[model samples]
Target: MPTSKDLCNKEACDIQSCLKKNGFIPERCRKVIEALERCCEKCSYNSKHCGSMSRLLGRKDEL
Candidate 1:
């Protein structure tokens, strides 16, 4: 059987690229980050990229 396509990869990459363009400032990448979060939520946080949510949100302590 063919494997399923991975989800949220583009959104995750967008966040990384946005951060790089903005000197690693999270505020500048808010929109992209939200996009990724939405994708993760839609997938029930099952995407591999979803594991970085807490870190991306700067709430690693809660994780």
Candidate 2:
């Protein structure tokens, strides 16, 4: 099974893409993105280089 962090990253990315394509407010998206960033920072599997990409994915409720 995929780790929770992996799942979070996938979900976040999907949400971010949807928000961007749908033209959602940047501020709102940023809020969730920030949360996603935090989650990525704490993830052992997260890559430093990919943190920005992880943030772009968007945030989800804590696992």
Candidate 3:
């Protein structure tokens, strides 16, 4: 299985593409993409899942 980091690192990993395909509004998904960028910038190996996990667990309602 591809880790989130590997998924994001792929040249084809367009967040907008994924969101749009999944029926998410591009505008709303932008926030998630932005957060992912911010988190990944600080992650070791630039792991994409690290950023995603941060956003997921950071959401008060989701926790």
The global C-alpha lDDT for each of the candidates, from Candidate 1 onward, is 0.74, 0.54, 0.52
**Per-model TM values vs. the true structure:** 0.78, 0.43, 0.34
Q: Deviation in angstroms for 53 in model 1?
A: 3.5
Error of 1 at 11 (Å): 0.2
Better of 2 and 3 by TM-score: 2
Which digits, one per residue and each the tens of the lDDT, describe model 1 over residues 22-52?
A: 9987877788888887888887887778786
Error of 2 at 30 (Å): 2.4
Clashing pairs in 2: 12-57, 13-57
Q: Can you write out model 3's per-residue Cα lDDT over 1-59, one digit (the tens) per residue?
A: 86655744532255546566868544545555655556565455367565544543245
lDDT of 2 by residue, 1-63 (tens): 765545456646654675777687555566556555566666643644244554344333331
Candidate 1 or 3, higher lDDT?
1
Model 2 ranges with Cα > 4 A deviation: 3-7, 21-25, 44-63
The C-alpha local distance difference test score for the whole of candidate 1 amounts to 0.74
> Number of clashing residue pairs in every model?
0, 2, 1
As a TM-score, model 3 comes out at 0.34
